[model samples]
Target: MPFKRPLLSSHTTDDSESQSDSSHGGPSKRRRVSSPRNIEKDKTVLVYILQAKIDPEMMSELAMLVENYKVERGNESLEGPTSVSELNLELTGDVEKADVIVTATNMRQRLERHVEWRIAKTKAIVTPLWLQDSVKSGRPVPYGSYIAVHHLEDETSRSHDTVQDASSGSPSNMPSEAEKQSCWQTEPTELIDTTEVELLSHTAKYSCLRPSPLVCPNQSLVKEIDVIRQGRNVEGEERSMLSYSRAISVIKAYPHVITKHNIRDLHELPFLGVKILSMIEEFLKTGQITEAQRMLADPRFQSLSAFITIHGIGPHTARRLYDLGLRTLEELERYYEVKPGVSDEETMPLLDAEASANTEAAGEQSIKIGLALRHDLGQTIPRDEVEEINGTIMRELGHIQKGCKSVIAGGYRRGKPQSNDVDIVITHTDWNLGSQKVKGLCRKLVQRLHEQGLVTHVMHLSGFHEHNVLRTHHWDSLEKALTVFVSRHNSSRQNVYRRVDLIFTAPEVFWTAVVGWTGSTMFERDLRLWAKQQKGMKFDSSGISRRHDSKLYHPRTERDVFKVLGLVYIHPTLRNADA
Candidate 1:
């Protein structure tokens, strides 16, 4: 037999028919009063129950109460088994057919994964405590309304009242005839609705032109896109990865919700091509993108992704490993003949034994350093630890040189919860003292840090190289040092080695260096591209300059550099282009 949810009401009605004969004696008049039974009988609502946190015993009791509740009036009894047929109570998993769903807060996310809000017509009502209390009493008891529904209605009413007062006049306090006349006589003011369009139409063309943070409206969709991009990168598909990055960049900057309607004109959006549009269209039509789903399930992609997660292996190396049938870290270790206790000097031989050996001597040396710090490179430095390290470095530098300063850059500057490494740009008051090079200042700093026992190992060091003043270039020949530092959070004797990059710059280019390194890589890339293509200028970590002019445009601050490039200054936190 079909089941019906119990109806609770504040008042009961007479079950006997209250009919009066008409004067014409043709028919009887029936007065209609709002009653719980009448309301239940009027609409046959299908209800679905979700036992999120409810126990089995309580659920069984609630089900029984729903099945056998009596609806009584003054004299005649309406409490029969047939009355349960009024409601089609469904215990099946087909939530779409339901009109009302009873669930808890914890079950909402679980349900959302299966049924999207637009397609599922069911209205979810949080299970209220009063419902249980009334069910236990087994009477026609009026319980409190669902908090979720009640709060939504309350918010809607409040918003409506506020809008009505602002746009239209209040009903209780009407203006006098004279005041109305004066209002009509006064000049009218035009109110422009600026809030409707949240995104800046002009600046939305490029992702770098706008500010994007780690959280946004399209975060979930962006995450899927990023996953596919990473898979492509693992297969050494640079072109495909670039295409996916374009799609990701545009989606990150989009301020509106991504729906089928909004993305219908995908061609009009920048960097979104046909291939990406098709994926998006598929995702909108169905809940998933076929290509991404297939890629996720592919064993080759899985192997490559896992291999790429290692400290030094990049996409190309990961692909080689995949081709060699090396799927897991254990397999990789066995293939490379990596011993349990590999020393720093032996790291190079182990790397060379891998499938894709480094060809160039310089590249091999870099890989050796990377291999040496493999464990440290993989460990994440928390935000607090980064700050603590920054403080210690600054204090040490201050002691070494009177006016030396450092600014933390890279992922930490962009407000990441954790970072792979800490980047610091160092400059001094006397850096501009009529010299092309700082004469072993990098070595001096390393020596001081080593004496203080903070420097664990000097990985690689590059001295200053002066660029030919006549040529247009992309990057600078700057003094830099990459080293591993020993860091400890508490009084633990064991030390954690973390990667630290120190880029020493002249005071003249300090601001530009800060703007360059304090980056989400994509942001820096787009900024440089924009500078060259749009302004006919060249920009790099060194400084900005006109392509035809010899003089460098030195900006004293990051905001000043943005102004020179005719861009709206973006804060560090908003520079997360992948967001």
Candidate 2:
């Protein structure tokens, strides 16, 4: 049984005296200081200040009051007065020694990494209010109401308690043997046909071979799993994130709604591991995953997700920013604020030398631009706007070089209602122009667009030579410009800033470029995987190349590329694998 704090005596007259003083129009009398008899003299308390919002001075004052009260007790031991020095007013990096930890932030957010181990050690983790109440009541307060419960801690404790109860021959919450066996033995009366299940099991292995629609019957379930996946991504769990992605792809391609009736069949699908299947089972039973819910509500996850949405920031950088305590875009902007006469060390004291150097090399300018246009860039681009933006680029390209054809790809090509950005693959049929000339196309077109007030900012430009023109062998190594485009809406009279990618490839590989740029990420990924594994060939935005001999095959059309790879041509509209 858990230890319970003793209740304060009801004979105490402090409350009545304070009320009498107030009613008589006199100054409220201060309550007399009393030593807390219930507190263990040697127990160590650590006050950890996590967030910037918490006042250190208040913690110090509270610690001083507690310490002074302990000293007033004059409790003597063999060495003399009992050590009032056991209490830590500041974070001392010795978490193991703390009997009680009072923190400002949520316990799950702060100590989630090792919460189970910490709980197993029997540490009483609570909020600052616990300490305040303990001091006010002249005794340590009951930890039941003040305990900061981490979700994982609760699960760990329940499992531990169940095991202990079973060993001790006490009534336990653990499922009975008969109940456990029934879960797997019980089958639904209406089941999917065995032949259909076999066919689905075979086809579901490769996402590229299947038609994944933008809208799926299991979208709600997929969304919850995806949130957990996103949380893993933010935490830099590469393998776990990929596993979740694979599971989500399989679920999205599933044509029917996921209910308990067909959940047993889901185990047949590729990438649906025991863990993922368990999550699906839990979701089917409760309509939500506990882990996903906790992650969705975590401030740290929210901040990291927001940071990675910026153009230049990746998971690693976003994690670093979170470590620096930057929670919002506004806070990030302030962190990068350049003040005159202040050194970098003074401006960003939290950043170490190595991090500072990495920041300078990591396109800080592009990140700042992303921050400035965060709202505009975050807005989804409708199909109409996507076409309009494509048209604007095409017009500008025609002026620079006639017969320059452009293909609008990305989510728009896959038939999504809205896209996050525009990807355009531009190529010319003039053989005389050569590879050298094609390399300069992106730079020239972007310059023309910038002059015309269409291209606002160039985030990145690559695959261009400065002095001597180099011959490019593959379409994947084509010249490209990542630019921000601004278009005016006539009705709203507002300038909408959009992200655009212009890929300039030679005419010979034009079809391959179109095939590469038109993608749902998993579709392209599996295409490459299948080509390498099954066909003994390498595939990319570039044309096909034989892996054995390294000879490139020029694809005349998008269908030709699929034909070369021995696959039936999947229409662009049906290429939404894990959309």
Candidate 3:
């Protein structure tokens, strides 16, 4: 069982009495000398819990379990009270007093920055399934050597060597060959400076796995890198752009502002290659990179960036527009009327014919409505207005389905002050049957919402065609409906049209959908990149799966997904790429 500690304050009544005794006892016996046995009896281990990334509920449960139980050694039954020296567990908030520091495996990556520093100060150990395993088996089983809390103070004090050398059927006794090469010893705890080191280590090599708020030290540096990355993207240099973005992410997660000294020390940092490092060095030295400045002045890049802002426009289409000398949204609108035909090898070659057919079939009124809706989607909504719309959605959804759930995703989920539009993912508790019924379920919900006058216009509706909801591969791909909503502002006495997307997911991929949709685009991009490039896994809105075997990985929660992918579970609020 887990050991319990007294809830008394750190300073006790006996300590004050000892001082008073010393003051009255004169010089001869004033110095109270403790024998080796007495000193040994008085020795106690101090521990500090790193609760930064730990779940509150789990932490509380662990603390309660520890408070209620006592540790027992081999062959000893947990029948009676154990001696104080046998296993005395005291949790301290003071890092200086802690002899051991406890943390979770999932938080290891985030804690990497502090590993060397913590190891110098205290014994840092990883205990996998800490609460569950300990509560189940009634004993602590350390997962790793460096961070293990296997033996209590009694057994540990008896003979340190025995406890250290004993085999406990772990993966291995000694460090693996791979780990051995990377291992380094620390200086004595007395010599270590806690003030100089960062406390919380990032849980993953990638910044996306850790929460990075807008107020990070390297925010300006990241912005500079992003401008260059955006230029790379505009020029169709995806590989180079990704490399730059990765470096930006690493810098953004860094705890302190970068200087020449610290920047040079970042050779070991993720994605900080020679080229990217040199670019950063150049920027730091001159306050800007010539290449980035040059790209900013380039007409092609300027045009492409603007063109891509149009609804339904992609890099390919933007590039095509740029080649045709379209430099602004106004220019694109003019060109659309002139040709109405734009195509590449992948796109429809009979684009003009298709446009004509679509117009003849749906009429000019439908085309005009589509254009107006697209224009509305491009407008940004204030945070207050966004909240009002969300409130209206909740009230409307509650009437549609009693137990319906809605998660506001996109930029809003990342804690953006404002959003271009609202993207909501809707799911019902009762609709957990499978993907087969998802299309119809979403159609029913959307139709009801439309009938209620909440959804003013349908821009794009997937899974349903020609008023028929079909169960096909296309419909099952993803059930989504994009519509314009009528948001009324009582203070302004106006009804504003705001674009809102309703994405539906089955019970199986509900969590996956929530995570995927709730993204700062770069966060999702880097997450997929890390999973594929680093872990040899595939991740998407659909689900996680092995690269080769195609076996699906079903995670019960969002944190479980991060664990499976070997990432730190970053909170939604800190996933903002803009910040």
CA lDDT scores, all candidates in order: 0.59, 0.64, 0.55
- Can you write out model 3's per-residue Cα lDDT over 393-476, one digit (the tens) per residue? 767766655555566778776667878888877654443344444545555665666678676555455552221133233223
Candidate 1: Cα lDDT at 343: 26
TM-score for candidate 1, residues paired by index: 0.59
Report the C-alpha displacement of residue 180, candidate 1, in angstroms.
61
* lDDT computed for candidate 2: 0.64
User: Which ten residues in a row are the worst by lDDT in model 2?
Assistant: 179-188
What is the Å distance of residue 127 in model 2 from its true position?
A: 75
Give the higher-TM-score candidate: 1 or 3: 1
Lowest lDDT 10-residue stretch of candidate 3: 181-190
- Per-residue lDDT of candidate 1, residues 1-579 (tens digit): 223432222121111111212322534322233432212222223334555555666666665545454222111223443322222122333455544445553232454665564533334343534234333432211111232232232332343233223222223133222222222111112221132123234236555686677676878788878889988788778888877887787877677777977786556778888888887778778867777788889988888887776545788988887788878766876675553223253222321242124335434444444544556667789989988988888788766666666678888877788999999887764434612444456667776787788875665566655555666542464567777778876457467778888888876677788888888777888889888888888888877888776567765456557768977656677767774
Model 2, 360-408: lDDT tens digits are 5446756776777777788888988888888878887888787666778
Candidate 1 global CA lDDT score: 0.59
User: What order do you get sorting by lDDT, best first?
Assistant: 2, 1, 3
| RMSD (CA, Å), each prediction | 23.7, 29.7, 15.2
- TM-scores of all models? 0.59, 0.60, 0.57
C-alpha displacement of 445 in model 2, angstroms? 0.6
